[model samples]
Target: MRIKAAVLHASPIAKPYAETRPLRIETIELDPPGADEVLVKIAAAGLCHSDLSVINGDRPRQIPMVLGHEASAVVVETGAGVTDLVPGDHVVMSFLPTCGHCLPCAEGRAQLCAPGAAANGAGLLLSGAQRLHCDDGTDAYHHCGVSAFAEYAVISRRSMVKIDRDFPLVEAALFGCAVMTGVGTIVNTCGVRPGQSVAVVGLGGVGLSSVLGAVAAGAERVIALDLSRAKLDLALSLGATDAFLASDPDVVEAVRAATSGGVDHAVEMAGSAPAFELAYKITRRGGTTATAGLANPNARISLAPVHLVGEERVIRGSYMGSCVPARDIPRYIALNQRGRLPVEKLLSGTGPLDEINAAFDLLDQGKVVRHVITF
Candidate 1:
């Protein structure tokens, strides 16, 4: 079938995406879902930094690829050997497509599945094939096994997490990435307990979501840190007890003073070396510093070797917030439905695929959070 989709060609494109226009919308061909795959007619998809990373050449990938991973869709058709889902079932797409039999999947750490990583890097489904092709006969690699920046997507079953039919698709799209990564880091990765002091170092969608997660988990104090005052205000509205600008040289000290000697847990979602360092510095003794940000592949953080032993500070990396989509997506969806996880506040607005280039500009400037492309 022919579908209108956004395709990213050569990277290192200039900014103001509207001018350079790295991601171009074009008519493309979509193959039928192969075995263990399903055809998802995308309802809504979010514009994540990860996608921008490709266009800006921060995270390079095979050229001529469809770019989009966070999305909500309806199962238009199921391929052979697919029994658990059928036509019309609403679902959210997981960027990682777990083969279920990989070593990581067997250990309940599907987020680290090697096969998924390889396929994502190569821009193909777990089956290792391109289901999308440009009009010029070039095969556009799939992005994170989803390639949801289009009208229709052929994705693997492992990437689909079925959700309630009544759930709002636009909001459901955020669960695919931001919510899962943010909230999951708190509840799953760090297991933040009630009355604990937590700091979220970044005010993007994921960081903001972490603020809500900390509050919902009963954190005694939630410190929201960011360079944008606008984002800080939003964080305060979303339950952050205090807000600080990361640009402040004494920001870490301020956070520590607010939490009576640093927070018990600091989640770094800014995806920068400085952000990671700040998170580590503001963590209380024996506190955990968890990072889910996708910093530059070449970026490095400096840690005090002695502090590791003296302070007993723990540092860990969180991919997809250490989330198991099947187990966590439903739980989060329920939370959002009940008004506990107000993810609705995270969405800035929506646009058609044509305006996606402009949306990328806003995303680049951190002018919006969770901008969804409505199909």
Candidate 2:
């Protein structure tokens, strides 16, 4: 099938600037799914920072790749042996898949499945061959194992989670990544309980979702920190108990003051070294600091050993919110359906695939939460 997609032909090899090389939308051909695969007609794709990381060379990936990972769609075709999902089913594409027999999956940690990484990262099907190509017959690499930037994508059946048909695909797409990562950090990693005090650094899409997650988990004080006043306002509306502008040098002190001493849980979503430092410092003794951001390769964070030894604080790294998509994506959808997860406000923009560059611009400027590419 012929589909429209944004293809990244070369790695940025430098910081991504809008005036420089940007993802280009072109017509491409998608091969039919092989056995154990499924072809999906993408309804909405969420632009994630990780995709931008690949473009900027922060996350080194093969060139000429289709750069999108978070998406929701309907099943169009299913290859042999796929009986659980059939055509016409709405689904969310998961970057990680559980092979069931893999050590991680069998251990109930599907988020770290090994085969899922090998299949998706190699840009090959489970059978070891490409599934997308340029109209002129050049190869197209798949990003994050599931490139959902195109109108249609062929992915492994293990990489999709069936969702309620009535759920809005646009909002559901965010759950595939942003929401999952943000909320997962709170529930899965931090295990935040009722009346717990939390601080979420960076009020972007991921940070805001963290705030909502903290509130849903019944946190009494959800403090949000960011330089953008606009995002802080949005954070407040989404359930943040208070917002702090990090531009002020006294931001950490202010957060400490708000939480009485220091927050019980601090989540770093800014992906900046400084933010990680602040997350670590702003937690009370015995508190937990969770780093959920995808930082650049050269970024380094430093902390005093005296503080670590004295505070006895726990610092952890979260990947995809430690989520098992098959189990978590559906629960997130239910959260949205029950009015617990406010997702509509998180959507900042929607346009055709050609507007991808513009969407990235908005993201870089911190002007929008998430931009959806509609094919």
Candidate 3:
């Protein structure tokens, strides 16, 4: 089948992506789903910073790859040995395809599945197959086994989680990444309890989702920080007790002073050394500093081991919010349905795939939160 998809031929592309047009919208060949795979028609795909990271070469992947990992889709067909799902089922794609027998999967840590990680790094499906090809017979790589920025995709069954048919697909796209990472970091990784003070650095879709997670978890103080005042205001409206500009030199002091020393937990979602450092500095003694941001591979943070020993500080890395998608996606969706998550507020707007470059420009400029490219 031929599908309209976005293909990146090279990376480290210069900015003003609207003009550079890094992602070429081309009609490409999509193969049928193989065993343990399914064909899905994409309904919505979100423009995330992680995708931006690839565009700017922060997180490089194989060239000639179709780059989209967060999306919601409808099952069009199921391949051999796939019995759990059927055609017409609404589902959300998980960036990592978890093989149930893997060590991490057996340990209930699907986010760390070894096979999934290897497959993602190699730009292949869990089945070790390449399903996308170009007109010139060039093979295109899958982005985290999803490659969702297209009209349709053939994905491993392990890469999708079935959702209620009625859940809005546009909103469902967020659960795949932003909601899972943001809310999962607080609820699953940090286990933030009621009345605890929490600070979240960065105010993108994921960071703001953390704000919602903190408030929903009953955090007495949900502090939000970012370079954009607009995002700060948005966070404040989403139940954050205080909002501060991350660029403020005294931001750490202000947060510490307001929280009566510091917050119990501080999460870095900005994917930068400076943001991680800020999160670490705002953590109270004996507190936890967690980072879920996927920073540049070369990015490094400076930390004092003395603080870890003397202050008893705990620093942890969170991937996919340390969530098991099969269990957590529905749990988070339930929260959304109950009106507690209110993830709808995060939608900046929607656009067609033809305007994808412009949409990316909006995301790169910090002008939008979660912009969905509707198919």
Clashing pairs in 3: none
Badly placed stretches (over 4 Å) of model 3 are none
Candidate 3 residues 175-258, lDDT tens each? 999999999999999999999999999999999999999999999999999999999999999999999999999998999999
Q: For every model shown, what is its TM-score relative to the native structure?
A: 0.99, 0.96, 0.99
RMSD of 1: 0.8
> What shift in Å separates residue 165 of candidate 1 from its native position after superposition?
0.6
Regions more than 4 Å wrong, model 2: 13-21, 125-127
Residue 336 of model 1, lDDT score: 86
Error of 1 at 225 (Å): 0.2
Query: Model 1, stretches more than 4 Å misplaced?
Result: none
Give residue 148's error in model 3 in angstroms.
Answer: 0.6
Higher-ranked by TM-score: 1 or 2: 1
Best by lDDT: 3
Model 1 lDDT per residue over 101-157, tens place:
889999999899889989998888999988998888888899999999999999999
**Local accuracy by lDDT, each model:** 0.92, 0.86, 0.95
Query: Clashes per prediction?
Result: 0, 1, 0
Candidate 3 achieves a global lDDT of 0.95
